[model samples]
Target: METKFDSTADAVAAALRELIVGGELGGGERLVERDLAERFEVSRIPLREAIQQLAREGLVEVFRNRGAVVRTLTAQDVEEIYGLRVLLEGDAIFRSVKRLDEETLARAELVHRLLGEAATTQKQGELNREFHALLYGACGNARQLASIRELRAQVERYERLQNTLLADTPSFQDEHVAILQACHERNARRARALTAAHLDSARRIVLEVVERLAA
Candidate 1:
Protein backbone atom coordinates (compact mmCIF):
# COMPACT_ATOMS: atom_id res chain seq x y z
CA MET A 1 0.00 0.00 0.00
CA GLU A 2 1.12 3.53 -0.76
CA THR A 3 1.87 5.75 2.25
CA LYS A 4 -0.50 8.63 2.72
CA PHE A 5 1.88 10.87 4.73
CA ASP A 6 5.11 12.56 3.74
CA SER A 7 8.05 12.72 6.15
CA THR A 8 7.43 16.32 7.17
CA ALA A 9 3.76 15.75 7.83
CA ASP A 10 4.56 12.65 9.83
CA ALA A 11 7.18 14.54 11.81
CA VAL A 12 4.72 17.35 12.46
CA ALA A 13 2.11 14.91 13.73
CA ALA A 14 4.58 13.16 16.01
CA ALA A 15 5.79 16.43 17.48
CA LEU A 16 2.25 17.58 18.11
CA ARG A 17 1.47 14.29 19.82
CA GLU A 18 4.48 14.67 22.09
CA LEU A 19 3.59 18.21 23.05
CA ILE A 20 0.03 17.32 23.87
CA VAL A 21 0.89 14.15 25.79
CA GLY A 22 3.77 15.75 27.62
CA GLY A 23 1.29 18.41 28.84
CA GLU A 24 3.30 21.15 27.15
CA LEU A 25 0.33 21.99 24.94
CA GLY A 26 -2.13 22.00 27.88
CA GLY A 27 -5.58 20.52 27.68
CA GLY A 28 -8.25 22.32 25.67
CA GLU A 29 -5.80 24.77 24.17
CA ARG A 30 -6.91 26.05 20.82
CA LEU A 31 -4.78 24.95 17.93
CA VAL A 32 -4.60 27.77 15.45
CA GLU A 33 -3.34 26.35 12.19
CA ARG A 34 -1.48 29.46 11.16
CA ASP A 35 0.18 29.77 14.58
CA LEU A 36 1.15 26.12 14.58
CA ALA A 37 2.51 26.34 11.04
CA GLU A 38 4.66 29.27 12.10
CA ARG A 39 5.74 27.55 15.31
CA PHE A 40 6.74 24.30 13.64
CA GLU A 41 8.17 26.06 10.59
CA VAL A 42 5.95 23.99 8.38
CA SER A 43 3.49 25.06 5.70
CA ARG A 44 -0.26 25.10 6.32
CA ILE A 45 -0.73 21.87 4.39
CA PRO A 46 1.39 19.73 6.69
CA LEU A 47 0.14 21.47 9.83
CA ARG A 48 -3.51 20.90 8.96
CA GLU A 49 -2.74 17.33 7.93
CA ALA A 50 -1.07 16.69 11.26
CA ILE A 51 -4.05 18.05 13.17
CA GLN A 52 -6.39 15.86 11.18
CA GLN A 53 -4.28 12.81 12.02
CA LEU A 54 -4.38 13.59 15.76
CA ALA A 55 -8.13 14.10 15.50
CA ARG A 56 -8.56 10.59 14.20
CA GLU A 57 -6.51 9.32 17.12
CA GLY A 58 -8.85 10.96 19.70
CA LEU A 59 -6.11 13.28 20.90
CA VAL A 60 -7.61 16.31 19.20
CA GLU A 61 -11.13 17.43 18.46
CA VAL A 62 -12.66 20.32 16.56
CA PHE A 63 -15.70 22.13 17.81
CA ARG A 64 -18.01 23.48 15.12
CA ASN A 65 -17.03 27.02 15.96
CA ARG A 66 -13.83 26.39 17.96
CA GLY A 67 -11.51 24.89 15.36
CA ALA A 68 -9.03 22.33 16.72
CA VAL A 69 -8.31 21.90 20.42
CA VAL A 70 -6.46 19.50 22.68
CA ARG A 71 -8.86 16.95 24.10
CA THR A 72 -9.45 16.93 27.87
CA LEU A 73 -10.15 13.36 28.73
CA THR A 74 -12.49 12.36 31.53
CA ALA A 75 -12.57 9.67 34.20
CA GLN A 76 -15.10 7.89 32.06
CA ASP A 77 -12.57 7.60 29.27
CA VAL A 78 -10.08 6.03 31.64
CA GLU A 79 -12.57 3.54 33.02
CA GLU A 80 -13.79 2.52 29.61
CA ILE A 81 -10.35 2.13 28.11
CA TYR A 82 -8.87 0.13 30.96
CA GLY A 83 -12.00 -1.86 31.61
CA LEU A 84 -11.59 -3.08 28.08
CA ARG A 85 -7.89 -3.50 28.68
CA VAL A 86 -8.59 -5.98 31.46
CA LEU A 87 -10.52 -8.18 29.09
CA LEU A 88 -8.38 -7.78 25.99
CA GLU A 89 -5.02 -7.89 27.70
CA GLY A 90 -5.94 -10.67 30.07
CA ASP A 91 -7.14 -12.86 27.21
CA ALA A 92 -4.08 -12.13 25.14
CA ILE A 93 -1.64 -12.88 27.91
CA PHE A 94 -3.51 -16.01 28.87
CA ARG A 95 -3.10 -17.30 25.35
CA SER A 96 0.48 -16.19 25.06
CA VAL A 97 1.56 -17.75 28.34
CA LYS A 98 0.65 -21.16 27.11
CA ARG A 99 2.97 -20.68 24.17
CA LEU A 100 5.87 -18.80 25.75
CA ASP A 101 9.38 -19.40 24.47
CA GLU A 102 12.60 -19.05 26.46
CA GLU A 103 13.96 -16.13 24.41
CA THR A 104 10.77 -14.11 24.74
CA LEU A 105 10.63 -14.90 28.44
CA ALA A 106 14.18 -13.66 28.88
CA ARG A 107 13.43 -10.47 27.04
CA ALA A 108 10.34 -9.87 29.16
CA GLU A 109 12.34 -10.40 32.36
CA LEU A 110 14.86 -7.78 31.30
CA VAL A 111 12.10 -5.34 30.36
CA HIS A 112 10.43 -5.82 33.71
CA ARG A 113 13.70 -5.04 35.46
CA LEU A 114 14.25 -1.94 33.33
CA LEU A 115 10.71 -0.80 34.03
CA GLY A 116 11.44 -0.99 37.75
CA GLU A 117 14.40 1.34 37.31
CA ALA A 118 12.78 3.66 34.77
CA ALA A 119 12.82 7.12 36.38
CA THR A 120 11.17 9.18 33.67
CA THR A 121 7.69 8.64 32.40
CA GLN A 122 8.91 8.29 28.84
CA LYS A 123 11.40 5.56 29.68
CA GLN A 124 8.96 3.78 31.97
CA GLY A 125 6.26 3.86 29.33
CA GLU A 126 8.57 2.45 26.68
CA LEU A 127 9.89 -0.35 28.84
CA ASN A 128 6.45 -1.19 30.23
CA ARG A 129 5.08 -1.33 26.70
CA GLU A 130 7.81 -3.73 25.64
CA PHE A 131 7.13 -5.97 28.62
CA HIS A 132 3.40 -6.12 27.89
CA ALA A 133 3.98 -6.76 24.20
CA LEU A 134 6.27 -9.65 24.96
CA LEU A 135 3.61 -11.12 27.21
CA TYR A 136 0.77 -10.73 24.71
CA GLY A 137 2.39 -10.96 21.27
CA ALA A 138 2.09 -14.72 21.13
CA CYS A 139 -1.71 -14.68 21.26
CA GLY A 140 -2.13 -15.37 17.55
CA ASN A 141 -4.49 -12.45 17.18
CA ALA A 142 -2.97 -9.65 15.16
CA ARG A 143 -6.11 -7.49 15.14
CA GLN A 144 -6.45 -7.61 18.93
CA LEU A 145 -2.80 -6.69 19.36
CA ALA A 146 -3.15 -3.74 16.96
CA SER A 147 -6.25 -2.44 18.70
CA ILE A 148 -4.58 -2.62 22.12
CA ARG A 149 -1.60 -0.65 20.79
CA GLU A 150 -3.86 2.15 19.59
CA LEU A 151 -5.69 2.28 22.92
CA ARG A 152 -2.35 2.35 24.74
CA ALA A 153 -1.13 5.34 22.73
CA GLN A 154 -4.28 7.27 23.59
CA VAL A 155 -4.09 6.35 27.27
CA GLU A 156 -0.37 6.95 27.63
CA ARG A 157 -0.70 10.68 28.13
CA TYR A 158 -2.86 10.17 31.17
CA GLU A 159 -0.46 7.58 32.50
CA ARG A 160 2.55 9.84 32.09
CA LEU A 161 0.68 12.79 33.56
CA GLN A 162 -0.40 10.78 36.55
CA ASN A 163 3.02 9.37 37.21
CA THR A 164 5.22 12.34 36.37
CA LEU A 165 3.15 15.15 37.81
CA LEU A 166 0.36 14.19 40.16
CA ALA A 167 1.77 11.14 41.96
CA ASP A 168 4.60 8.68 41.87
CA THR A 169 3.90 5.90 39.44
CA PRO A 170 2.87 2.78 41.25
CA SER A 171 5.31 -0.09 41.07
CA PHE A 172 4.07 -3.13 39.20
CA GLN A 173 7.09 -5.23 40.01
CA ASP A 174 5.24 -7.56 42.37
CA GLU A 175 2.38 -8.11 39.96
CA HIS A 176 4.75 -8.59 37.08
CA VAL A 177 6.77 -11.11 39.03
CA ALA A 178 3.66 -13.01 39.98
CA ILE A 179 2.39 -13.00 36.42
CA LEU A 180 5.72 -14.18 35.09
CA GLN A 181 5.90 -16.93 37.65
CA ALA A 182 2.41 -18.12 36.75
CA CYS A 183 3.33 -18.12 33.08
CA HIS A 184 6.46 -20.12 33.77
CA GLU A 185 4.47 -22.58 35.78
CA ARG A 186 2.11 -22.91 32.82
CA ASN A 187 -0.76 -21.71 34.96
CA ALA A 188 -2.81 -19.76 32.42
CA ARG A 189 -5.69 -19.11 34.77
CA ARG A 190 -3.48 -17.52 37.39
CA ALA A 191 -1.69 -15.46 34.77
CA ARG A 192 -4.98 -14.14 33.37
CA ALA A 193 -6.23 -13.19 36.82
CA LEU A 194 -3.03 -11.34 37.61
CA THR A 195 -3.13 -9.42 34.34
CA ALA A 196 -6.73 -8.36 34.96
CA ALA A 197 -5.93 -7.15 38.45
CA HIS A 198 -2.86 -5.36 37.17
CA LEU A 199 -4.83 -3.42 34.58
CA ASP A 200 -7.60 -2.64 37.06
CA SER A 201 -5.04 -1.25 39.48
CA ALA A 202 -3.70 0.91 36.69
CA ARG A 203 -7.18 2.13 35.88
CA ARG A 204 -7.68 3.26 39.46
CA ILE A 205 -4.35 5.06 39.70
CA VAL A 206 -4.88 6.88 36.41
CA LEU A 207 -8.37 7.97 37.40
CA GLU A 208 -7.09 9.42 40.65
CA VAL A 209 -4.75 11.61 38.64
CA VAL A 210 -7.46 12.57 36.20
CA GLU A 211 -9.72 13.67 39.04
CA ARG A 212 -7.01 15.89 40.48
CA LEU A 213 -6.27 17.41 37.09
CA ALA A 214 -9.96 17.99 36.43
CA ALA A 215 -10.26 19.78 39.75
Candidate 2:
Protein backbone atom coordinates (compact mmCIF):
# COMPACT_ATOMS: atom_id res chain seq x y z
CA MET A 1 0.00 0.00 0.00
CA GLU A 2 1.36 3.44 -1.00
CA THR A 3 1.11 6.34 1.39
CA LYS A 4 -0.73 9.34 0.05
CA PHE A 5 0.29 12.91 0.66
CA ASP A 6 -1.79 16.07 0.24
CA SER A 7 1.22 17.03 -1.74
CA THR A 8 2.39 20.25 -3.27
CA ALA A 9 5.51 20.33 -5.43
CA ASP A 10 7.63 21.51 -2.52
CA ALA A 11 6.39 18.64 -0.37
CA VAL A 12 7.14 16.13 -3.06
CA ALA A 13 10.58 17.64 -3.61
CA ALA A 14 11.36 17.46 0.09
CA ALA A 15 10.48 13.78 0.19
CA LEU A 16 12.63 13.02 -2.85
CA ARG A 17 15.48 15.07 -1.39
CA GLU A 18 15.44 13.04 1.80
CA LEU A 19 15.61 9.80 -0.16
CA ILE A 20 18.42 11.06 -2.39
CA VAL A 21 20.50 12.51 0.46
CA GLY A 22 19.97 9.42 2.58
CA GLY A 23 21.46 7.33 -0.26
CA GLU A 24 18.27 5.35 -0.74
CA LEU A 25 18.29 6.73 -4.26
CA GLY A 26 21.87 6.35 -5.42
CA GLY A 27 23.62 8.37 -8.09
CA GLY A 28 22.55 7.80 -11.69
CA GLU A 29 19.41 6.06 -10.53
CA ARG A 30 16.47 6.92 -12.72
CA LEU A 31 13.41 8.59 -11.25
CA VAL A 32 10.48 7.07 -13.06
CA GLU A 33 7.64 9.56 -13.09
CA ARG A 34 4.79 7.06 -13.04
CA ASP A 35 6.29 5.06 -10.22
CA LEU A 36 7.11 8.11 -8.14
CA ALA A 37 3.69 9.59 -8.79
CA GLU A 38 2.02 6.43 -7.54
CA ARG A 39 4.34 6.15 -4.55
CA PHE A 40 3.88 9.80 -3.58
CA GLU A 41 0.16 9.61 -4.46
CA VAL A 42 0.42 12.82 -6.40
CA SER A 43 -0.63 13.78 -9.90
CA ARG A 44 1.95 13.79 -12.69
CA ILE A 45 1.98 17.60 -12.76
CA PRO A 46 3.32 18.08 -9.21
CA LEU A 47 5.65 15.11 -9.60
CA ARG A 48 7.20 16.69 -12.67
CA GLU A 49 7.41 19.98 -10.85
CA ALA A 50 9.24 18.31 -8.01
CA ILE A 51 11.70 16.72 -10.40
CA GLN A 52 12.40 20.10 -12.00
CA GLN A 53 12.93 21.60 -8.57
CA LEU A 54 15.58 19.00 -7.70
CA ALA A 55 17.18 19.52 -11.09
CA ARG A 56 17.54 23.21 -10.38
CA GLU A 57 19.11 22.35 -7.01
CA GLY A 58 21.68 20.13 -8.80
CA LEU A 59 20.56 16.97 -7.06
CA VAL A 60 18.93 15.61 -10.21
CA GLU A 61 19.52 15.91 -13.90
CA VAL A 62 16.88 15.42 -16.59
CA PHE A 63 18.29 14.00 -19.79
CA ARG A 64 16.60 13.43 -23.13
CA ASN A 65 16.06 9.70 -22.88
CA ARG A 66 16.35 9.58 -19.11
CA GLY A 67 13.66 11.81 -17.63
CA ALA A 68 15.37 12.39 -14.30
CA VAL A 69 18.42 10.81 -12.66
CA VAL A 70 20.11 11.40 -9.34
CA ARG A 71 23.25 13.37 -10.07
CA THR A 72 26.68 11.86 -9.43
CA LEU A 73 29.10 14.52 -8.34
CA THR A 74 32.47 14.54 -10.02
CA ALA A 75 35.60 15.58 -8.11
CA GLN A 76 35.50 18.78 -10.12
CA ASP A 77 31.90 19.40 -9.07
CA VAL A 78 32.83 18.96 -5.41
CA GLU A 79 35.76 21.36 -5.79
CA GLU A 80 33.62 24.02 -7.45
CA ILE A 81 30.81 23.71 -4.89
CA TYR A 82 33.14 23.99 -1.89
CA GLY A 83 35.16 26.73 -3.56
CA LEU A 84 32.06 28.90 -3.79
CA ARG A 85 31.04 27.91 -0.26
CA VAL A 86 34.38 29.03 1.20
CA LEU A 87 34.05 32.41 -0.46
CA LEU A 88 30.38 33.00 0.34
CA GLU A 89 30.29 31.50 3.83
CA GLY A 90 33.57 33.16 4.78
CA ASP A 91 32.13 36.55 3.91
CA ALA A 92 28.91 35.76 5.79
CA ILE A 93 30.84 34.71 8.88
CA PHE A 94 32.97 37.86 8.75
CA ARG A 95 29.99 40.17 8.53
CA SER A 96 28.00 38.17 11.08
CA VAL A 97 30.83 38.26 13.63
CA LYS A 98 30.79 42.06 13.62
CA ARG A 99 27.05 42.04 14.25
CA LEU A 100 26.90 39.18 16.76
CA ASP A 101 24.46 39.78 19.60
CA GLU A 102 24.44 38.16 23.01
CA GLU A 103 21.04 36.51 22.57
CA THR A 104 22.00 35.08 19.19
CA LEU A 105 25.32 33.80 20.48
CA ALA A 106 23.55 32.12 23.39
CA ARG A 107 21.16 30.43 21.00
CA ALA A 108 24.06 29.32 18.84
CA GLU A 109 25.77 27.92 21.92
CA LEU A 110 22.74 25.80 22.73
CA VAL A 111 22.57 24.51 19.19
CA HIS A 112 26.29 23.76 19.30
CA ARG A 113 25.81 21.73 22.47
CA LEU A 114 22.98 19.80 20.87
CA LEU A 115 25.11 19.25 17.78
CA GLY A 116 27.86 17.76 19.94
CA GLU A 117 25.36 15.37 21.47
CA ALA A 118 23.83 14.27 18.17
CA ALA A 119 24.03 10.45 18.00
CA THR A 120 23.37 9.99 14.31
CA THR A 121 24.74 11.59 11.18
CA GLN A 122 21.23 12.78 10.25
CA LYS A 123 20.77 14.48 13.60
CA GLN A 124 24.24 15.97 13.42
CA GLY A 125 23.61 17.36 9.97
CA GLU A 126 20.34 18.98 11.02
CA LEU A 127 21.82 20.54 14.14
CA ASN A 128 24.94 21.62 12.26
CA ARG A 129 22.81 23.54 9.76
CA GLU A 130 20.85 25.14 12.57
CA PHE A 131 24.05 26.18 14.32
CA HIS A 132 25.53 27.73 11.23
CA ALA A 133 22.26 29.46 10.32
CA LEU A 134 22.06 31.04 13.78
CA LEU A 135 25.56 32.41 13.48
CA TYR A 136 25.14 33.61 9.91
CA GLY A 137 21.66 35.07 10.42
CA ALA A 138 23.21 38.39 11.42
CA CYS A 139 24.96 38.86 8.09
CA GLY A 140 22.28 41.36 6.87
CA ASN A 141 22.42 39.90 3.38
CA ALA A 142 19.53 37.59 2.64
CA ARG A 143 20.63 36.90 -0.95
CA GLN A 144 24.06 35.77 0.14
CA LEU A 145 22.55 33.56 2.81
CA ALA A 146 20.14 32.02 0.32
CA SER A 147 23.00 31.26 -2.05
CA ILE A 148 24.92 29.69 0.82
CA ARG A 149 21.93 27.49 1.60
CA GLU A 150 21.59 26.37 -2.00
CA LEU A 151 25.27 25.45 -2.12
CA ARG A 152 24.98 23.49 1.11
CA ALA A 153 22.04 21.47 -0.25
CA GLN A 154 24.06 20.72 -3.37
CA VAL A 155 26.80 18.96 -1.37
CA GLU A 156 24.83 17.36 1.47
CA ARG A 157 25.20 13.95 -0.17
CA TYR A 158 28.95 14.37 -0.31
CA GLU A 159 29.03 15.53 3.31
CA ARG A 160 27.31 12.29 4.28
CA LEU A 161 30.03 10.41 2.41
CA GLN A 162 32.71 12.17 4.46
CA ASN A 163 30.98 11.30 7.73
CA THR A 164 30.61 7.64 6.73
CA LEU A 165 33.91 6.96 4.93
CA LEU A 166 36.50 8.96 6.86
CA ALA A 167 37.18 7.51 10.30
CA ASP A 168 39.83 10.16 11.06
CA THR A 169 37.89 13.25 10.02
CA PRO A 170 38.59 16.20 12.32
CA SER A 171 36.05 17.17 14.95
CA PHE A 172 33.59 19.68 13.57
CA GLN A 173 32.66 20.24 17.20
CA ASP A 174 36.10 21.70 17.95
CA GLU A 175 35.94 23.91 14.89
CA HIS A 176 32.44 25.09 15.84
CA VAL A 177 33.70 25.97 19.30
CA ALA A 178 36.49 28.03 17.81
CA ILE A 179 34.11 29.77 15.42
CA LEU A 180 31.62 30.56 18.17
CA GLN A 181 34.43 31.92 20.33
CA ALA A 182 35.53 34.23 17.53
CA CYS A 183 31.97 35.45 17.13
CA HIS A 184 31.78 36.07 20.87
CA GLU A 185 34.98 38.07 20.73
CA ARG A 186 33.72 39.91 17.62
CA ASN A 187 36.84 38.89 15.75
CA ALA A 188 35.60 39.15 12.19
CA ARG A 189 38.88 38.25 10.52
CA ARG A 190 39.47 35.14 12.56
CA ALA A 191 35.91 33.95 12.07
CA ARG A 192 36.21 34.44 8.31
CA ALA A 193 39.50 32.56 8.12
CA LEU A 194 38.19 29.72 10.28
CA THR A 195 35.05 29.39 8.21
CA ALA A 196 37.09 29.17 5.02
CA ALA A 197 39.46 26.61 6.48
CA HIS A 198 36.63 24.48 7.88
CA LEU A 199 34.91 24.28 4.54
CA ASP A 200 38.19 23.64 2.75
CA SER A 201 38.96 20.72 5.04
CA ALA A 202 35.63 19.06 4.28
CA ARG A 203 36.10 19.70 0.58
CA ARG A 204 39.46 17.93 0.57
CA ILE A 205 38.14 14.91 2.45
CA VAL A 206 35.05 14.58 0.27
CA LEU A 207 37.05 15.01 -2.93
CA GLU A 208 39.49 12.28 -1.91
CA VAL A 209 36.66 9.89 -1.09
CA VAL A 210 34.79 10.72 -4.27
CA GLU A 211 37.90 9.92 -6.30
CA ARG A 212 38.46 6.68 -4.42
CA LEU A 213 34.85 5.65 -4.94
CA ALA A 214 35.18 6.37 -8.65
CA ALA A 215 38.35 4.26 -8.90
Give the TM-score of each candidate: 0.87, 0.91
Best by TM-score: 2
Q: Write down the TM-score for model 1.
A: 0.87
Candidate 2: list runs displaced more than 4 Å. Answer: 1-7, 165-170
| Candidate 1: tens digits of C-alpha lDDT, residues 186-208 | 89899999999888777777788
lDDT of all predictions: 0.84, 0.84
For model 2 the TM-score comes to: 0.91
